[model samples]
Target: MFGPRHPLMLIAVLLIAAAPAPHRPRRIVSLNLCADHFLIPLADRGQIAALTRFARDPEISAEAARAAHYPVSRGTAEELLALRPDLVITSPWRRAAIAELLRGRGVAIADVPDAQDYAGIRANIATVAALVGHPDRGTALIARMDAQLDALGPARGHGRTAAYWQRRGFLTGAGTLVDDLLRRAGLANLATRLGRPALSRLSLEELVANPPDFLFAEAGPVRDQGTELLTHPAVLRAVPPRRRLHIPGALIACATPAYPRAVANIAAQLLAADRIPTRARSQ
Candidate 1:
């Protein structure tokens, strides 16, 4: 091995070792569900001052189980200020007023982008990891996610199509995270055929007239008109109960490093759906 030729080169190395690491925020708070996903994996527990109240909501937050171990916030600016966090992370599209107010008070606020695809997802992970002073962890997490996604294979549904049917018949459209997940599972989104926008309402009559090969809906009941829509005689007659897949919103609803789990879950459902004999299923 070759050594530093000059004594000054060795002196430079010594100075670098003696230098202190850059400052990292100690009290971190996640103001939203998606923000909790980033902070949970990237920060030390001691560093996490608080998380959003929804962190424990199994219906939405992906890290609900993990979030249970940390202190949860009430989502009010007053409660967040009580935590005395150096940083508050939330979605830019949501709570803009809170974000601005917090900034006015000299708190550093970072917004998690609503990542629609793998590239956006990767950028989001890297962004949060760097904020938490563990950029390397982000890199490793992405690599793991990529490997899992690769093993999951692509959307292999052939001509089979599906839709992420939500409350009030709100369909998640193309270019959204849910659509990307459906594609990764080898399923085409029915939203495309309907010419729906990023998010649009579809009447029961319309849905019944042009049903998809499958429907991706939440496992829990909404106890509202959405429930009525799901159980509607026309909808049942068209798609039937067997074609409905109950993928929880937590597995989706936001961009997280655990995205591969969503993709794998959907892919498994499609594979299982294929097993039903069409002749028998029609009746």
Candidate 2:
């Protein structure tokens, strides 16, 4: 122990003990749509330097409104490098050129995975949160998602068949993210029963002939019947109006924390359809 008379020794020991740890990233930049969604809920607004332009479009991003407060980028190397973010988040699958360019210039970058199931979603949320110095926030968000799912009870997957029919006769197939969500919500995907591929074409005739318990039509009205197959006259006539529930592009477009909300939305729609009187539904 240093004696009171030895002031120099005591001062040196105190300075060494109180030395601060290195600082973490203060500014983060996202170069992909999924990465933007991950950053929005996990990082503080101040931590975010810029999000991709998709973050501003509600049609593709579930966090459009939340992202409005932050500056957005188009993933240009020059613009991204200008921000000098402490950490850069992106998807190697997307914006590959930009990701490569930034990395070549010695910028810190992390790739966000493309999640196809609940497990993937949780892993992604946790990954992003930890990188942003908010692992607990990720845990809390996941817990909330779990609580929401638990509240839904285990009675879902009543074996009721559903279809995520999109534009141009495109149907969401089995072993896909939407399919997984459908099963979680207690509904079976029609694509599996139909034995369709990932991008199968379901003609209006087949859709009408084998109508599922529910018909999930894509968002928007029939701007052009030739292109917008969901609005085909046969589909409109065969699928009962009450049986249809249009899902916005934003909900199923990404596998983010908002995913639980999508599940709940579908469940709510199913419940609403069930509530309709059989006679009126058939009319």
Per-residue lDDT tens digits for candidate 1, residues 3-98, read 666788778899999987745789988876887888888787898998888988888888989988999978786887788888888777755786
Please give the distance, in angstroms, between residue 145's alpha carbon in candidate 1 and its true position after superposition: 0.5
Scored by Cα lDDT, where does model 1 land?
0.81
Clashes of each: 2, 2
Model 2, 60-157: lDDT tens digits are 89999988989998877779878988788877765466556666566667888788899999999988888888888899999999998888766444
How well does each candidate superpose onto the true structure, as a TM-score? 0.87, 0.86
Each model's lDDT = 0.81, 0.82
Which stretches of candidate 1 lie above 4 Å from their native place? Answer: 1-22, 93-96, 99-106, 220-222
Q: Which candidate is the best by lDDT?
A: 2
**Which ranges of candidate 2 are over 4 A from the true structure?**
1-23, 94-96, 103-105, 154-157, 226-228
